[model samples]
Target: MSQQPYAPRPQDPRPRGGTPPSGAPPYPRHRPPRPPATSDLRLLLRLTVASFVLAVLGGAVGLLAAPGQLTGVPVGPAFDTFVLVGSLVLGFGVTAGLYALVYFPLREQRQWAWILGIALASMALLSTLANAALLLVGPAGASPGLVTGALKAVVDVAWLVVAVRPGVRAALR
Candidate 1:
């Protein structure tokens, strides 16, 4: 068999002296796409704020439903203990919800929101666990104690899941 000779590389001629590729000065390339638009962000903010309000409302309802629970630290009931307890729940719920908002602007891709979301989720999980434990041990397994404990645990877990949702996180941001 005979080997073929190597051919020289050929250059294509430009059509009618058109602008040469890479000949023109480089134009500014756009920076990485700015995150989602402000309108979308506004929606998220609204959702986050609404969720926080809902949580506060839920706490108020819970307090109304049961008046004696929600004990503060130091093993003592301050003035208007029921109101104080309810207020605490509302405050905590609102704070947790608002905590989720900090990351909403970047909710679609924000790492901080993820961190905060995880923290909030952990809080919910902990609340559930503590409530479950209380139900098991408080008042030697009183019916109301068990019920309330279990109920609170369920609510916390549910809220945790909601807070961790991508859409929710984004909205809060």
Candidate 2:
């Protein structure tokens, strides 16, 4: 076989500096596609509203169910005053706090909202469990207590799940 010298391929007409041709973009332009709008935010809002409503209802029920005197405690001037005033204040204060501290700020996507929400949901879950326990062990009671406890448990669990969801956390951010 005869030996032959290698030949160089033809060079591109473009400049050697890696710059694009005149009037062309300096670099290829690429943008990542935008993420789809999350519907979880709307669901979170609806769930929050429902929770607010439930809190209000529970407050009303607490006031209505308030006993005239504290039971299983010694009857005295100081004890009576504490029982009467303390219960009312603590009950309503917690409900109001949940609204002001958690629900309102949550609408504005505050970072603390989920923290407070988790606490609130935990408290609610505990309360629901207590109510269910009372209903189960106390007596053959009316259906409302059981129904309300069940609903509250479900709502609280849903709140906890939604609060930790990736979409919900991103929406808050």
Candidate 3:
């Protein structure tokens, strides 16, 4: 039998001289899911400020505990100098790095912000842990009587608090 006539395709009543069916959404209409407001920013900021402050204070303590570490570059019998120098470098480096990382979200870089934040937070945690270890293992053995030592302890705890903050953890997601 003869095939039935093909039904006319429904006509799009769009205005005549109007734009053609420009392929799906000109460009992909994908909008990344936004992250829920997180408490991490506060935590991160607190940690960063605390870490920086502690680094400065720790540097001061190292200066007092082992002045020679800075004044003179020891060629021998300078274990104190070595420890002081190593600690100062580590403390400053880690703190500065974390501070920078923690600020990424303020820029609202979205996913990148969270990524860098988590990475930096982890590093900060490790750095503080290492500092605590040194304080306990070295001669001081967490018995630092100086105000700077107390400051260092306070800031280290602050860092831990930030790392565990809900906002920061959410940012990681």
Q: TM-score for all predictions?
A: 0.41, 0.60, 0.46
lDDT of candidate model 2 versus the reference: 0.70
Candidate 1 stretches with Cα past 4 Å from truth are 1-31, 34-58, 69-97, 106-108, 139-173
Error of 2 at 164 (Å): 2.0
Model 3 poorest ten-residue lDDT run:
7-16
Per-residue lDDT over 31-62 for candidate 2, one digit per residue giving the tens place of the 0 to 100 score: 55434435675677678777767766765554
lDDT of 3 by residue, 1-173 (tens): 43645533358434344554656354356777656556666555666666677667666666666543344445654775677669878967866776675565633535566556556555645665666666667665335424555565566566656655667656553
Model with the higher TM-score, candidate 1 or 3:
3
For residue 43, model 3's alpha carbon misses the true position, in angstroms, by 3.5
Best by TM-score: 2
Shift in Å, residue 123, candidate 1: 2.4
Give the whole-model CA lDDT for all candidates, comma-separated: 0.54, 0.70, 0.59
For candidate 1, the per-residue lDDT at 91 reads 82
Clashes of each: 6, 0, 4
Best by lDDT: 2
Residue 157's C-alpha lDDT in candidate 3? 62
TM-score of 3: 0.46
Which runs of model 3 end up more than 4 angstroms from their true locations? 1-40, 70-98, 106-109, 135-173
